[model samples]
Target chain A: MKKKHIYIYSPSSAVRDKAAYRRGIQRLQALGHEVEVDEAALSTYQRFAGDDRTRVAALSRAAASRADVALISRGGYGLTRILDAIPCKAIAKAIERGTEFVGLSDFTALQCALFAKTGAVSWSGPALGEDFGAEDGPDEIMEACFDDLLQGQGEGTGWRVPPREAEMLAGFRGLHGATLWGGNLCVLTSLLGTPYFPAVDKGVLFLEDVNEHPYRIERMLDQLRHAGVLARQKAVLLGHFTGTRKLPHDRGFDMRTVADRLRGLIKAPVLTGLPFGHVPTKVLLPVGAKVEVAADGRDVFMVWGHRHAPGHRAH
Target chain B: MKKKHIYIYSPSSAVRDKAAYRRGIQRLQALGHEVEVDEAALSTYQRFAGDDRTRVAALSRAAASRADVALISRGGYGLTRILDAIPCKAIAKAIERGTEFVGLSDFTALQCALFAKTGAVSWSGPALGEDFGAEDGPDEIMEACFDDLLQGQGEGTGWRVPPREAEMLAGFRGLHGATLWGGNLCVLTSLLGTPYFPAVDKGVLFLEDVNEHPYRIERMLDQLRHAGVLARQKAVLLGHFTGTRKLPHDRGFDMRTVADRLRGLIKAPVLTGLPFGHVPTKVLLPVGAKVEVAADGRDVFMVWGHRHAPGHRAH
Candidate 1:
């Protein structure tokens, strides 16, 4: 594979760990990839990576730089503040030039905004500091999956969930051309009723979150469900929800119970255990990509791009 | 004043404190009001006041009961689940018969749905168990305010906030007939993009919440602002936000800082210290009511209903 240029920048909240950011850049270079760090990546303005102007300028610069991939340095709580000011057309132009804009969590806002404003697809996967710069190094699965995606070899990803989820997915077998979308639940929910929200019809929406309890998750899903967003989807994928603390008030209602309630409410199939979100071993997914999904017993496979061959089957 | 017929029911989460429910009923009765408890009020199904069918039935019955006041027993996580099954027309008819549906927190969903579906005004105030049946008895301010509202005497409520907030409110002076809407921030945000969200134009939106930190609060506010809801409001009154624990990651950002950031982003005046929401000494606010507001130094007064007399101006 040709050596790809990766432009690393921070578009959200400030990255507090300077050492991790340095290590991340080093690792990317060591992996035989050309890395360019944004001038504002280390700039701090309050809790943000920089002031709104600085972050916006950095993003605009990255988009115009024409890198093969523009990866976020970290994800926090800043992109939302600068959504209106972001150079969407520039970013879309970058995507037109084959830049796979990638990051998760707060990046969901930017990705969704890009899709809404330009109908361009971006990768919903790892960040530089959080994933590549982990103290123990990136998880093998994540690194391999990312490498394949960057090399244009990873056309699809597969994972096995609990057997019960197979029953859920069975209801939606042979569903074809479903637009695959969604990322961090809270960020996605934040875009609701806003111009930045994408009006994707019959899309397979996958969601994940961190540090939010079942009730909060349920509330966000309820918002989407009530908004008629859920009924228009071919399927709803559930990824990992971590860093939550159980409260005494929950009474027996947990994430599973929440999922059950959602299954009862939404017309679309609700399948769990997708390898995505705030987890180490995750797949690189293309947001806004048309894909086909199938289930075989306890296994679920999602195929997109060139991987959706005529003879391909879920087995 | 005539004895008011007050219907007490649990239409959302179940009330684990049965004793408190009973005490609340006794308090209403002691205040010379006829209290009708819905049969399903005490029924428990998981964390809900009852199953969806039962809760929906109770709400429909309350709306059709034609009581002077329909007060919820408590607020929790259930109303969003049964939003579809709710009888909006029936509730509107009940409001037509002079029933003032009231509650906060999760009740925001039901209240906003009512306003959206039928444009009926409800109360964003106390609940039966949590407010009237408080362990220390109903708060004097809350009790007095409730009395005044039930007797049609509390046409307006006023409170003093920090003098600095007066500058924020100054931008909206002479603003009349701003539809006063909104409740718990999270619940209101949940209604965003949903059919049940009221498209209030140039309204005075008041928001309050519990157990949410500054970042979360700021995120929700950003959503509303980005959605153009905040820009459409004549003023944004912030009520009590309590019960949140400070996280180490917050650095120096706090509720005050969050308010400052919102003031910068929104076009409307952002005033703080409204006497409402998840607090003991709250003022009963008429949700969806058309009202006028004015700021005098450190004092803010909101006047609605027939109390807008020539001589009844803010001091």
Candidate 2:
């Protein structure tokens, strides 16, 4: 095990708190690791990382070049605006040199594209402006990710997911393991048909989203179902689908209806209400790990391990 | 002009309401046209048109074979599920016989697919469920759409749209006379890189969506922006993007900011807050009609037709 450096990036235009972003840097620094902050990469406007494409692009390239790991400053809106401006080839070349990129929410597009173009392993985890920036989430979760990156430590299992009513099984069959993929549902859906969305066949699919109504959420699930993404997965794991409310005059449609529609449409075993998304408590999910989503009694557990490595499969 | 027969068809799951499905039948009948409710074509399930490949495929083929003008029952989801199951060649053969089709919302998938696969003159417009079954829109709108379909009655000159203090663009140049094509933003984005989205290199793109938070809405816009869909347009016409406080925690995103984003991203002239979507007062916008977006006057006016078509462009 060796020390790893993580780079941070942003793709959304929603205004972020400066103090919060700094706190994330401090938290990571306290864990006895080298930390770097390039102000040039921070968003200047309410939602943009920065309007200056050169600064955004240069910081993106520099972060990749300098780090063993790359993280997003935050997720909102703006990456699609600056992605072409960023040096994709150089970023890809840097990943080949061993830097892993990660973050979630609006940053999903960038992670997907990075994986698509460079095959770099990307995780949908805490961003400085989003997750770690907040006062919530246990310090242990952050430590968990950090330890996993370096030393590959704290790799335990039998993780408990909530609602416990999630389904599984369509293209999914007896005991197959592959890398976990996907991020915020809204962001992942945006990359539909784009070169970014990797093939999900025989892969475990994970999704989460914030502030989408039941019908809109249902429609997105419909989009994935119709596109054959949901049906092709070996198993479906859902995180948070927040902000669903029933309108007074609009009782005909709601989030539960959406959940039901998804259950009906997708033959794959679908699970709901996983503790992730725009919530306080979050789980550190490694995207490119050999993880097992096995059924244990009435509950299902997602376990990860390093093959043939010491302390592997501790769960 | 003689009234034309419009058949209702939705293969795969029926995402629309049965009442609306029935209402569409009644509306066309009330307008003095031959309307038939084929029970076999109707989906028994509330949310789904049908289940299983065999049933959906049979229903789709039979409906396509019998219909003159197929007014899609509604577009909530399902077409793509049974797309490969249906006989594309037969549908193409039916389109060759000059059978027209129209629907918007989730229906965009079917419309785009049929058009791409068979060259059908499919359109994005009022769905049978939300538009017709509910007895809820302005009488004028219903009259306008029906007349346009039945008699080819053109709409009147530059109609005034209601004003909102949205993100206004300075130096908004006037653009007149461009073909209109597009519907829900979510639907259109889904059609990206798909066969259904027409090449509108210099055409006006009309868009609307319901129940999407500002962030999600912005992301869809970003998808269109990054894909260069917006830059290719001659002018951008925004329809109603309804904001609802369904969830207690849901703070609606500003549509004005959306307009501002479009202004910043699109080189083409962009306008906002048109009355068209899940609203009481909706404008019947022909998905493929020539219209004028004039910014030279005190307000933004969308003028379509030869100036006497009973249609007034919303300002």
Best prediction by lDDT: 1
Candidate 1 residue-wise lDDT, B1-315, digit = tens = 768889888888888988888899999999899999888988888788888899999998898777778999999888888788888888877776667788889999998998898888888889999899898899999988888867767888888878777665555565688899999999999989989899999899999999887788888999998888898998888999998778766667789888988878777778889988789989988788899887777788898865324333221
Candidate 1: regions farther than 4 A off = A306-315, B169-172, B306-315
Work out the TM-score per prediction: 0.94, 0.71
Instruction: Give the CAPRI rating of model 2.
Output: incorrect
Could you give the interface RMSD of each candidate, to one decimal? 1.5, 5.8
Q: What is the Cα-based lDDT of residue A222 in candidate 1?
A: 89
Tell me the lDDT of model 1 at B97: 60
TM-score of 2: 0.71
Worst 10 residues of 1 chain B by lDDT: B306-315
Best by TM-score: 1
Per-residue C-alpha lDDT of model 2 across residues B137-239, encoded as one tens digit per residue: 4256655764564454545333343343222433555566676667778767866554445666677887888877665677778777766677778877777
RMSD to true structure for each model, in Å: 4.5, 7.2
lDDT of 2 at A143: 51
